[model samples]
Target: MIREALRKLMEQAPLTREEARQVMTSIMEGQATPAQIGALLVALRMKGEAPEEVAGFAAAMREKATPVSCPEPERTVDIVGTGGDGKHTINISTLAALVVAGAGVPVAKHGNRSVSSKCGSADVLQALGVNLDLDARQLSRCLEAVGMAFLFAPKLHPAMKHAIGPRRELGVRTVFNILGPITNPAGVRRQLIGVFSRDLARLLARVLQQLGATHILLVHSDDGLDEISLAAPTYVVELKEGDIREYRIDARAFGLSPQPDGITGGDAETNAAIARRILEGEAHPAREVV
Candidate 1:
């Protein structure tokens, strides 16, 4: 059955929502071999995933993920970016998550270790003394105590381990890449998601809309930075109250200068330092990017 589905996907036919869900279920249940999983992922990437397929896959992941609850789900927000942007920026979204939390917004930040960059959200957070191995209860405590919690993707979605080896071996972006941002374990209704591509930005907005997301900002920069870019105009698709609006935002609109030269942190330690400087108002570029 899986082979026939893969053949159809390879033939450029999109999967029905049910077929996509079944495929992901098989992969997560360890029923699909590594070779079969790799082939299916590559085929889907090549053929381009439909929004239905992406939504179905995300539904399966959310079903399998360990849910973390907060006292106020509606008041909580998540800030995350699809990590394969290859920009190696100074972990802007993670910093933004911190700032948002500091301003008293409950934040359930979801992320993993580095995929295409020297530092990911988990990596930098760990460097800054965050314990990433908290259980669901501990995570809830963190949120209640500090107005923020980091839902490490691997910890929340243990079923993903079945595909990790295959995903690393394949070493390319798949539907799973986009799925991560949409599948917040805390099930946050409000989010700011940065995608590596403009197409992904539009597609994710639609997926979030279908998933009943209340307020979401899907952003992609013209220069390829995932988060709202200071270097270039950012294309934004906002999903609010079931209506989707597409627009572009420039840094100058916010009274900030365009920073075409990107910021870089060579490692997690450096990224942590950069984040601290931004928080302390010592780094202008890093502060502006956030």
Candidate 2:
């Protein structure tokens, strides 16, 4: 069945949602070989992922993800970005999650270690003394205690263990990259997702819409940064109540001035320091972008 799916993909034929779900199910169930999985991912990337394919994959992932409960799921939001921007900017989404939490919004930030950047959300969070090994119950407790919790992707989506080898070998974008943000373990209906590519911003919004997301903001900077950029205009696609809207936003609209310098790349510790400083009200234009 996996081989047949791969053949269809190689022939430039899109898979039905069920077929994509079955393929992902097999991969998660350890029924597919590493070689087959690698071939399937590469073929899909080359052909470009369809909305159905991404939505199907996300469905299967949600089925296997460890469930984290929220007392008020409707009010909770997840802030995540599909990495692989290769810009290695400071963890803007991570910092934004903290700010959102501080502003009285509950945050269920889903993240993983670095894939294409020097420091990922999980890395910087770990640096700040966040325990990434918490169980589902503990995660819920954290949310109740602090109005925020970080759901480490690897811990939440253990089924992804099967694809780690293939993803590492491919070393490029795949459907899984986008699926991460959409498959929040807490099943939060609200989200703010950042995409590495402009096209993906709309594509991801569509996928989230299909998944019955209540409210979502998909952002991609014109300069190619995944998060809303201070350096250039950012393209935004908002999904709300089954309606989709697209728009472009400039920094000045938010009372922010465009900074000429881009975010610098660094290891987890370095990025964590920057996040700490920003949260402490110390002024820095780069931190203001958060």
Candidate 3:
């Protein structure tokens, strides 16, 4: 653990394969002090988390997190965003989960209320009256009943609770922000991930690869959305059957010819209202994209 802190403080990247596993194992064992932990976290962020570091630490999280048992792994899809969009959009990814479910795909989305944006996937979903605090059993039932279930971040990973206050106090985008999307408790093999930056989309792809993700569509919008923007082109990095591909998706593909400026929100209440429109079938562009 001390070595990780030293390496990070030196402005070097992150841990090697064995080192990451060991450090994370130590953390899970409650061996590291709070002071050591905070130092390591801040240093890693400053150095810009490396691919192996993200992969290794996330792998540790996956190991400790409560696993959800699914009868059919092949049919499950997770739709998530890294959520630094700053657009304050009305939970576009959460909205898309409904549309994706409506498309005959089984969705088990993991989300939280907005920390980086005005409304998060969980916030907008909660506004629509879908329960976000369900346990694994209730959540699984919701997925079976509605073809979608919302997995709240706090409910899934209890171990991270201690760091929550520290992360908030740091007042910057911590590694925990990116960790949410990567740590889908449902363990869905397929993922549709939206990131804020084009470069980070590609970088996240590599981490997902290490995490043993099967089929993934990683996207970034030119206009700073964590979703496929109808107003501009969306860059995509995809991994299918162990093959990685990068491409561009035009707004026209979503049937938005005039290019909508993308969904914007003022607060939870405002976004929730938009979500109501989606559920009631107002048939808007957000609806089409979702």
lDDT of 2 by residue, 195-268 (tens): 88878988888888888999999989888888888888989999999999999989877788776463675999
- Those runs of model 3 whose alpha carbons end farther than 4 Å from true positions after fitting are 2-4, 8-13, 258-262, 283-285
User: TM-scores for all candidates?
Assistant: 0.96, 0.97, 0.92
Ranking by lDDT: 2, 1, 3
Q: Quickly count the clashes in candidate 1.
A: 0
Per-residue lDDT of 61-154 in model 1, one digit per residue for the tens? Answer: 9989999998789999999999787888888899999999999999999999988899999999999999999999999999999999999999
Collision pairs in model 3: none
User: Which prediction has the highest TM-score against the true structure?
Assistant: 2
Looking at model 1, report the run of 10 residues with the lowest lDDT sum: 257-266
> Which candidate, 1 or 3, has the higher TM-score?
1
> Which ranges in model 1 have alpha carbons more than 4 Å from their true place?
none
User: How far in Å is the alpha carbon of 77 misplaced in model 3?
Assistant: 0.3
lDDT of each: 0.88, 0.89, 0.77
Q: Could you give candidate 3's per-residue lDDT for residues 154-238 as a string of tens digits?
A: 8877776657655666788866778788888889979999998887888788888887889999999887778887777889999
